[model samples]
Target: MPGTYPVPPGGGRGAGPATVPGDLLAELDRLLAPSVRSLRHSCAVDLTFGGSLAPGSRDAITIRHLDGHLGHTLRDLHVRAGYGLGGKVFSMGRPLVVRDYFNTAHIVHAYDRAVAPERIETVFAVPIRAGETVVGLLYLAQRDDVAIGDRIVARAVEHTRRIERDLAVGVEVRRRTAAYDEAATRDHRAVADARRDLDEAISLVGDPQARRRLREVSQRLHRITAGDDSAPQPAADGVLSARELDVLQLVATGAANGDIAAELGLRPNTVKAYLRSIARKLGATNRTHAVSLARESGLLP
Candidate 1:
């Protein structure tokens, strides 16, 4: 996790929050709201909201991903540890339920002003975790005091678990992509070194034939395998320029704009311009979608 999410300043998770992969957080922004919607639909709940421990947030669980929300009740609400229903879950690392949210003696009314707007009653809060790390949380609520029974609990857990699995996969992909890039960089350097040496050798040769033979070898050295030369790579569907392709490749690895700019020797603003163009040409709604579209279009490997 190159962009490690720091733990909530000395108060949230005692041992420090888990270093969530930036890819996982980005994926959550793309994936979690849909998961919450599905759960709400399947369970027939009145309201569903998904929350993630966003980067740079110290102790609030107010970073709702998207629209599973019923109203503006929870907007601008920062539920910290030991406060609201969500904060308690973040602190306790376990699911909690209240048959009547306002009347319950179990949790505080920190978000009461906010929660009051939805007129929500019984609420079920589950920690959206990957292994033991609590990356985020899922909430299921209704306007009435529905029984916080096995069925509701089971449904919420199952859906949240799927989200957890997705988070895990995103983290794994981030790890593998970084590893692959590191190896590829090393191989590139090796190829460059070999070609430099070959060029030096070719220059020293007296015979034109030997020099030509060495030059041919030097040209082929950059190819990963002999088979790569046999088939031409598919032309990018959008005909993305070389710089655009470079930006997208880094995007696929979940690199932030600053990192991508640094790698490509461009200004941050220039990187943003490239991304906007990439998104428009690809018809991609977001960064994650752009990478997916590029891969599907065979514009990326």
Candidate 2:
């Protein structure tokens, strides 16, 4: 919430994409692989691994990622909150270390079977957090019984900070994307409602000139709420049939063929036929183009 995401590959986080790709869990994993690779190469840590909290729960940490494991002993490891080193880190919201995991008295050995097969002696864990909540764990392990010095801990924390920033940005992106989608839905429904009300008013008007004026006002409303952004060209000569004009109105509102069909009591195939007819009359190449040209020729609002 405090900072902005650097523009990602496809667009900026503020640009409001539909959803954060792969959700929050996958965002954690995205940065984890590179961090693990860097940690294993940058320092003497024989093993580097991490896991995100399973979505919707903070009681368990599932490790699907690791580097330098000789066998599959630690693959997809599950560590509960407050039990193993990772659990202690999760529960305390801080880092934890053990010179000898098998002999450690500082934490319980709930994951002894998982670690015994790894033959790892020194184990270090750091909490990856978003705001005040611990969202994940990062682990550093070695085969020798040795103290994890402050130097390595600081480096590990540096990597953890990167992960923290990534998670925070991911959270913001998800929030923004959801808000954008909701606003779009709200706009869509509003256009439909306004169109319905305006059409009802036009039907009640008995005077021909007043009815025509009302129709022009309706077109103006459609243009404001629903027109495309693309530049327009002069419309072609042929006049669109009434049914084709009806189809164009819904198209301007960004309705799909199925929705347009249901709205006008036409079949899906009939909607498609009307769209083709509209395009031909307007000299347009596509749905958006048809709407733009119709607006250009004062055929649509």
Winning model by lDDT: 2
The 0-to-1 C-alpha lDDT of every candidate, in the order given, reads 0.70, 0.72
Candidate 1: tens digits of C-alpha lDDT, residues 1-301: 0111112111234113556666666776677768877888888888888777666553556647434466776855667767878887777777776767787766777778888878888777777665666767778887886675677778778777778787778878888999998987887787778778876776677654454445446545634433254432222345678999999999999899999999999999999999888876665658897787566556687
C-alpha-based local distance difference test score of model 2: 0.72
What is candidate 2's lDDT per residue for 1-301, written digit by digit as tens? 1111111111111111122234676778777888887887777788988887665565676787888988787778877787878887777777767776787677777888888878988888877765666667889998987777778878888878877887779778888999998998788779768978987887777664465455545555565566543324223344778888888999999999999999999999999988877765554668998887566556777
TM-score of 2: 0.65
Candidate 1 has which clashing residue pairs, if any? none
Please give each candidate's TM-score: 0.66, 0.65
Q: Which pairs, if any, clash in model 2?
A: 219-301, 223-301
lDDT of 1: 0.70
> Candidate 1 — which residues are off by over 4 angstroms?
1-19, 66-68, 222-301
